[model samples]
Target: MMISSQKVKVDPRDAKLSMAHFYVAFTALALGGLAGLLQVLVRSGKVELPYGIGYYQVLTVHGVLLGLVLTTFFILGFQFAVISRTAGTLSNRARKTGWIGFWIMTIGTAMAAAMILLNEASVLFTFYAPLMAHPIFYTGLTLVVVGSWIAGGAMLTSYIRWRQHNPGKPSPLLSFMVVVNTLMWIVATIGVAATVLLQMLPWSLGLVDTIDVLISRTLFWYFGHPLVYFWLLPAYMCWYAIIPKIIGGKIFSDSLARMSFILFLLFSIPVGFHHQLMEPGIDPAWKFLQVILTFLVVIPSLMTAFSMFGTFEMYGRSQGATGLFGWLKKLPWGDARFVVPFIGMVAFIPAGAGGMVNASHQLNQVVHNTIWVTGHFHLTLATAVILTFFGISYWLVPHLTGRILTKKMNRLAIIQALTWAVGMTFMSGAMHAAGLLGAPRRSSFSTYGESAQAIEWIPYQIAQAVGGTILFIGIILVLYIFINLAFYAPKGEQEFPVGEVTDNAERTPMVFENWKLWIGITVVLILFAYTIPFIDMIQNAPPGSKGYKLW
Candidate 1:
């Protein structure tokens, strides 16, 4: 039987807690966006801030705030809402634990932000070892990770309680996805956790004289690629479980959706070495294996695309539209929530293709550390992930606040999405073009005494600045919409969209729900992928590098 669309109203306390998480997330978005604007302008050689804020500092702020802080807060809050509405109302103890996690994360964010602003932690978000920051910076980030762990624990506890009460029943798909994400996070973070606690934290505190850059980077990318999935899966959750309903259709296949998520859990972490394809310290054989694994992970993304198209086509035909492309016209283009995220998915098409290039050993040589890599991530993380977050915020803020998303605000949100699309197109396109022309990324200035090649980058640089300015304006509009939605909109209960399965007869396989089996396989894949390379690196490692603070 298809699951019903019933949604339990969130408890007022839970709503307040979720709102707190969102408020912090939006604040991070604003600050990071301003930093992004500064970056493009300064790099274009058009404007220079008189303040002590240098390029590296702004870059650090932009990366940490948006990439880490904003995503963490928003994901936690969205999952909380999903669990509360789908699984059951959280226990009082769980609610209390959630609040504690929030405070811990908030305090940690402040500590890290202070260090960055004071120029004590300009190591950048990558924080590649030997380019050290103050000890407090590492400590703060550790706390943030620990805080997320605590929050994940609370989510797990809630799911366990629900499972206990109802034996032999599949968990709600939304809660199931959240739990899977939580476990994936717990497993994936071990890499970065070890890197920080054993390596970076000690080295920063002067307890260690030097650290292995190769090993540290190995650990970072181990967590790093999966971290991209962590940002993505939540948006995918909405796409799989919610978007179909918004467009007047049910999910194409619940089984396929579950399997895709499970596959992601198994494959995401083991392929991190693909990011290091251009690095020499790693063996070529290991890199090739990772490149193969990287391609394997693409399967789930293709599955998602296929399922979404099928669902849209089914709905279109039901509405009497004819022809192969008729579904395109039937989609709810005017709905801010649907349209905004749909745009994000469209952006992912090229982002995913570019990723394959990055993973290719021969092809990566052209783009490594260039503006092309920066553009690729901007398309993936900045466009696909962040734009979906904006779409979620539109409905989510109102849902939590028990307020109506007024027509005027909805129109503004559509405009904001359009503006972002235009802005990112110009900026990221220019970045990719400039990269082909030998433009370096992360440089303070590109013009080196009128070198012709460097001079050729000027127009693209100007285009980037122009795009960034437009994007900043869109950010402001989104913040305004959120503020008004949370505090000033007319009070009303928001409908939580949950897409039902169209084929009720096709039950999800029991194997798809076997958590232990999936986890076991995931661990095995990770071990197989990393064991030899890590051991080889450690045993034959070169002398470690000491800290440097060039910035």
Candidate 2:
């Protein structure tokens, strides 16, 4: 006997949301790309801008819009899909709340961008303590955070309601990502809100003359770093769950996939301090503690990457893909989502692995606050994280529009991915070299003397600019391809109906719910954090103390 359950087709209306969100994300990328170009122009002396305003403003805009708005809404779409599926019915309330959240967040994001443009909130989206912003900036940011909080809440409620009705089966993988993202946002934003309410807002409103800056930055990074993972998890979910299915394979280990998400939720939170490793005042031992946890945090990423690639290789061989690298050819190269991760893998080997070295306390000192750090993150964020979003867009668009994507558009997207990979790799590597040579980041001018005493290397900065130009072109191509696909692609093909394909075989029902696994991981991980407060006492210095510096 065979079992059957109803699966709703993806709604055509959701296409509007996906397309709208895509515009936001892609436009943000475009602005960020322009920032890259400006940096190059300044460094190369190709064109002189009025002030550092051009670069800094763009940088601030790019980071906040891309990091907060783009990622948040895109993930919201993914959440909608999951809610529609696993919940058996997508609630009208969730649908409405999501759209409302989208609009509110968009307004907030625009205000935030305006703040940067007007130089009101150049504090960076990290919104560190004591560095107050204009009231509109904070208000705008508050709206954005609140909207996302509501959106996340809606998702959690939907999932919970669905699980209550569907009891006994583990939630589907897509839904699981939505749930995890919601949990992370809830946990992540607590710090952001606290910083805004207790620190930045108070100071900005003239309630306090001076505030504790370290505490504010500490809380902000706590939100910021894991928030990176929050954005990336949706893409990883697609990688683990959908990409394999597209390639005609099953997940290598469902349990491992579950564990991976659980670990990410737990480990990513406490380790944000790693980003501040080079700052003064923090104890060396505490910094070292974060460094160790940061390294430990890489385990889940490696595990997920290995598991996903392993699944692909196994399927490629099963489909007669032949030997080691031969699976490369056997992949569904025509599929954009499939190719995105394929290229993502190429970058991660260098970026992700090298990133581990960069995260090390000693290595970070060498590279801290340098172009190397920028390169490391851009590779990971752009190559792996943004690539995943593009992949999901490919999958979502047609499903939303009830149309099949043109093969040409998919091919071009792959080209864009390759271009981005090449560009980011070169740019980031140059930045790393510049950093190692003691070239500072966030500076519009190096002014290296003839001896190059203060500014050791200028050429690498120029290299970054050139590489950034390549990235700019790549980003433009991506946007152009997507725009054309949405507007120009003919609607002749049958709508891509959502459901498991014929090749999707019957599998045993999900019987195991190892809540203990996650709980255990949480307990073990906190053992590492338990020593944070005491770290200064034992090391004889608080974090950021003069004696506790990494550099």
Best by lDDT: 1
- Residue 254's lDDT in candidate 2: 61
What is the clash count of model 2?
9
Candidate 1 residue-wise lDDT at 46: 80
Q: Candidate 1: what lDDT?
A: 0.88
Candidate 2: stretches off by over 4 Å: 1-8, 50-54, 129-131, 446-456, 492-551
For candidate 2, write residues 1-551 as lDDT tens digits. Answer: 11113234555555465456666767777776676577667765456767547655656666676667667767776676656655545577766777787788788878877877898887754655444578778878888888888777777777778677777777666666677767777777877888787777867988866655666676777778778788778777777777766676667766677668877877887776678776665677777777777777788888987887788787788877776788778888777777887787667777777678777777777877776777777777777878877766665665566555677877888888888878886788887777777776666663444555444465776677778888888878877876766666666442322223224334434532444565466556645653464354335543443222322
lDDT at 454 for candidate 2?
41
Give the per-residue lDDT of model 1 (tens digit) for 1-551. Answer: 23455455767788888889999999999999999999999988888866777789999999999999999999999999888877888999999999999999899999999999999999887988777899889889988999899999989999898888877777788888999899998898899989999999988888978887888888999999999999999999988988888888989988888989998998899998888886767898999998898899899999999988888899999988898798789888899989999999999999999998888888888888889989998999999988898888888888889887888998999999999999999999999989888788787563464678668899999999998999999899989999999999999877777778886527777676677899999989999999999899878777535223211
The global C-alpha lDDT for each of the candidates, from Candidate 1 onward, is 0.88, 0.69
